[model samples]
Target: AQSVSQHNHHVILSEAASLELGCNYSYGGTVNLFWYVQYPGQHLQLLLKYFSGDPLVKGIKGFEAEFIKSKFSFNLRKPSVQWSDTAEYFCAVTAVSASKIIFGSGTRLSIRP
Candidate 1:
């Protein structure tokens, strides 16, 4: 069975601290991975995604993710933290042939200013 897994349920960070959110999948075949974020009062938006070509993809707000095929992991990274970056992050995966998308349990990030 293919599924997405998120290691952190809640995370707290101070301003200027580095952040890393772990995400892994169990699919044996090829898959498209994505990181989506929802701000406190805003709609969910894409942070980054990995489909093909580059293993590393950069997204808005200094966010980046590296896809490691061997580990079935696509971890999100941010060098610095801000209060505005506080949000819930979800990792998603979908197979190229499958229409359904599986989402991991979201991680809530809180930043102290």
Candidate 2:
């Protein structure tokens, strides 16, 4: 079984500040990593994904993540953040042969204006 761990449960930052969220997963075989975000009232949206090719993948809204297979980590980062960026972020993993996705505990990001 695969599981995700989000190191941070809550994060606070001022507008224009940088952000980084740590994520680690447990899986021995091939897997896919993802970052999803949910606004206050919006549905969960896919922020980024790593299927193949480059380990460093760029996502929407200036977000990027690096998939480190050796460390089993897929950390998310943003150079600068806005107040509107406040949301709950989740890191998920699904094995290549599995259909279910295991999600992290989730990190709540609060950006002050």
Candidate 3:
């Protein structure tokens, strides 16, 4: 079974500040990592994902995640954030052969102007 953990429950940052949300998964075999974001009243949107071919995957809205297999980590990063970027971010993981996805608790990002 695969599980995800998001170390930060809530993150408050000003506009243009760099952002990095820690995400770790417990899975030994081949797996896939994903980052999803949900705006205040919007549905969950796929931010980025990592399966193979590349350890570093770039996502929508200037977001990126690096899949460090050695550390079982897939942390999401944004060089600069904006007020509109405020949302709840979730880290998910699923085995290559599995259909069900396990999701983290979620980290709320509050961007202050």
Candidate 4:
């Protein structure tokens, strides 16, 4: 079974606060991981990715994630989030043979100004 899950269906935060969203995947083999963000009134963008190498990968907009192989998890985090950071976050994974991606349900982050 290969699947991705996001624990937080929705999240709310005040401006300038730390943010963390949990993601878990069910897969037994090597895979590619990614985090995509969709900001309010904006298009979807790639936040980061983990194809290989370091487990701790950085992405755009001051966001980062650590891939834990043992736990089958890739959680997104930010030190301090702004109201502008408000968006819907998705965790995704893919196999070498699979051309398409497997996406988590999603996490909605609403940062209050």
Candidate 5:
């Protein structure tokens, strides 16, 4: 079984500020990591994902994440954030061949204009 952990529960940033959210997973074998964002009153949406090929994966809305196998981490990053970026971020992990996904508690991002 694989599990994910998000280091920060809440984050606050000003517009155009750089953002990074820590996400760590516990899985020895092949696994997939994903970052999902949920806006106010909206459903969860995929931000980025890491399955294979590249360790650094780019996603929608200028979001990206780097998968560091050695560190068991897949941290999300954005060079600049906007006020509209305010949302809840969730980190998830699953075995390559597994059907069940384990999600982190989630991190709430509050962006100031």
Candidate 6:
């Protein structure tokens, strides 16, 4: 079965800090990767995606992720983050199954002011 797993269920940080979350998938085929972020008080929004071109993709609000086929993972990373970046992050993957995407549970990010 195709599945995605997130490393942390919740993360806490100060107003200004760096953030890195792990995301792993169980599949060995052509895939489309995505990272969706839901702000503290907002709906879900796309952070980034890896379709076919570059393995390194950058997204809104200074967020990015790298797709490592060997590791079967696509990890999200941010050098510096702000309180506004506090949100619930979910990693999703779409394979050739022609079915819906497989999304990891999620990682809740909390930024303390």
What TM-score would each prediction reach against the true structure?
0.96, 0.98, 0.98, 0.96, 0.98, 0.94
How does model 6 score by TM-score? 0.94
lDDT of 6 by residue, 1-113 (tens): 78999989999988668888999999878899999998877898999999888899999889999999999989999988888887899999999655798999999998898
Segments in model 1 whose C-alpha atoms lie over 4 Å from true places = none
Collision count for each candidate, in order: 0, 0, 0, 0, 0, 0
Local accuracy of candidate 5 as per-residue lDDT tens digits, 47-107? 9888999999999999999999999999999999999999999999989889898999999
lDDT of 5 at 58: 98
lDDT of 2: 0.97
lDDT per residue, candidate 1, 1-113, as tens digits?
A: 89899999999999999999999999888899899999999998999888898999999999999999999999999999889999999999999878998999999999999
The worst-scoring run of ten residues by lDDT in candidate 5 lies at 1-10
Worst 10 residues of 6 by lDDT: 94-103
Model 5: per-residue Cα lDDT at residue 23: 95
lDDT tens digits, residues 1-113, model 3?
A: 67899999999999999999999999889998999999999999999999899899999999999999889999999999999999999999999989899999999999999
Q: Give me the runs in candidate 4 sitting further than 4 Å from their true place.
A: none
Which pairs clash in model 4?
none
Candidate lDDT (C-alpha), each: 0.94, 0.97, 0.96, 0.94, 0.95, 0.91
Residue 96 local lDDT, model 6: 65
Query: Which regions in candidate 5 have their CA more than 4 angstroms from the true location?
Result: none
What stretches of model 6 exceed 4 Å from their correct place? none
Write the number of the candidate with greater lDDT, choosing between 1 and 6.
1
Residue lDDT tens for model 2, 25-74: 99999999999999999999999999999999999999999999899999
Model 4, position 106: C-alpha lDDT score: 96
State the lDDT of candidate 4 residue by residue for 1-113, as single tens digits: 68999999999999888999999999888999999999888887899999999999999889999999999999999999998888899999998678889999999999989
